[model samples]
Target: MAAVIDLNEDVHTLLPLTEHRPIGTLPFAGRYRLIDFPLSAITAADIHSVGLFMPESERSVQDHIRSGAAWNLDLIQGGVFLFPYVATRDYQNDDLRARYYENYTQFLRGSGSKYTVVMGAKNVANVNLNAILNYHKAGDNRITTVYKKLPLDRIRPTDWTLALSEQGTASAIVQAKERHDDQGKNEIPSFMDIYLLATTDLIDLLDDAAQSHVFRRLPELLRDYVLANNANAFEYTGYLARIDSIQRYYDSNLQMLDDASFQSLLLSSVPILTKSKNEVPSFFAKDATVVNSLLGTGTYIEGTVQDSVVFRNVVIHHDALVDHAVVMQGSKISTGSTVKYAILDKGVVIGPNLTIVGKPDKPIVLRKNQTVFRESEVEGSAHA
Candidate 1:
């Protein structure tokens, strides 16, 4: 199988986090990045070749997925290929597959496979593509998409929604809209925006969509394809979290604290792969008081930490209190600092005696390399 990942610009919604890096490289689950879920799924399907259509932060992407060795995509031939799109300020990639049609087509032509799997990375889930591929092969359809039935509010309003027929065929897709009914039974079929199609069929669809001029975006074009052609929908019954908003991001991370949710997503059948960093085991100082937290390698805790996710090489100085927060790699919480319900990105530094607080409804977020002064009150920002 040939695969192409569209690290779409929709990641911009993930603000401050996406401000400095692609969502794919955004740290998740204490250690792994967002892209690891899809890449790991592709590798599990035994698809050796991959073409990443990166439109932003090309350097950062290269650093994380360097040589694709972790995903077993380091093969001599048909390994990993990165296509960085360099366009003008007003450029929007939703109109076309790549900067130019020739670019995407070139990758398709040389992928040396019959089927192609196209996806967007914001949706985090550990799915087995082999099952979806088998469903496509069992039928004579030209395309197959993955979807789940859930409340519309669970995902973003811009996410694609699918209404399926009794026969399991997807009939119509709409830009997700909110339902006012707080009733627990109101659920809609939401598309995961993952597709599998034959290479020849994809080329044909591209030519058709271009000529019609009515469908320029890949998802819109595919929506029409499902309507016209015999496209099927495969129901994905697993943990699905679309990190389109900051609240959603924070909620999803905290949800990982649940053993069932954590086991199903990270310890599922497919092994999630990430760039390995060699670091010493975490050290807890005698002055530390920690409980119910996920601490990564090289993490040094000397403060009071409860119910948080701390990444590698982080330093929590003495007299600090971190409660119900997510702190990324290389962050230093100075002595006498207190951070609650916050997310500290890479290399962040908190001054001595600083106090940052947030509610469960709105968590504080400090971007990469951000610094906070002592005795500061960080509230109402939903962003720190």
Candidate 2:
């Protein structure tokens, strides 16, 4: 089976962290990027051919997946193909659906596989696509969609939830906002945005969409198709952390600090793979006191770090304190500074003796390459 990865998800809520990169390339868990989870799942299933469609800049994505060597998708026979949307004056006024359909149809036609797997990057989970493929092959359904039962509060309004029939098929697809608790169910079958279907059926859907002038994204289009066609629903009983908002992102990262959650997501049978980086080991000074934190390589820590995730090449200078924060690569917390419940983007330099703190529910976000010398500079920078 071949795979199609959509990277066109909205990132406005994840801005500052997503300013210089796509959501797929955003740093996570000290080392891995968000793209690594889906790509790793695809690789684990031994699916070699993948078509990644991106709507914005490809520089960061290209750099991270360079040749797709990490995912073993660099083969000459069947490899990863990147389809970046190019905006030209000829199609300036036209909706992106035209370009999307053209590129998608081309990729699907060239895949030469009987089945196709469609997925997105925002839903963070280590899914075993092989199991889903086997399940789909056993059934006679045209499409098999994956869903995870989640609490209503965890399901965002933009996310889709499925109403399953007695036969374990999707009878209806409802948005999280429109969901009604007629049966008094606290948890709903939240769509994981992963689908497996016959390549021919996918092509037919695309053709009909083109003919009807529909402009929905691939995932949304597939959602409607699933409900209308009564697609089979495969329940995924695994750890799933949907990264839809800043609060969710922060909570998801911090959730990794728990041993069980970390093991469940990262150390499962399906391994999460990422690009290899060669760097020196992190260093903690003699006076440094670290507790329950994940530190990346090449980091020099001389402060007190607790319950935080610090990325590569970060420096916590003498007497600084980092508590419950996510510090990206190349950021420096100067001596005597205190960072609590905040997210410092890459290349941020916090001046000495400054205190940057935020509440537990809402963390302060510092933009990329921001250098704050005085407290006044951080007054209105919180985008919580």
Best by lDDT: 2
Candidate 2: regions farther than 4 A off:
86-97, 380-384
Model 1 ranges with Cα > 4 A deviation: 88-99, 152-156, 178-185, 210-215, 375-384
What's the true lDDT of residue 42 in model 1? 95
- The candidate that achieves the highest TM-score relative to the unseen native structure: 2
In candidate 2, list every pair of residues with a backbone clash. none
**TM-scores of all candidate predictions against the true structure:** 0.91, 0.95
Per-prediction tally of clashes: 0, 0
Q: Give the C-alpha miss distance for residue 119 in model 1, angstroms.
A: 1.1
Tell me how many residue pairs clash in candidate 2. 0
Native-to-model Cα distance after best TM-score fit, residue 10 in candidate 2, in Å:
0.5
lDDT of 2 by residue, 1-384 (tens): 999998887889898788778788888999999999999999998998999997586789999998999999999888999997654343433456566677888888898989999998888898999999989988767899899999867777767788888788887678878866536777889988889999988988887776654356677688788777888889998888888788888999999999988998999979999999999999989999999998899999999999999999999999999999999999999999999999999999999998898878978889999998987788543321
| Candidate-wise lDDT, in order | 0.81, 0.87
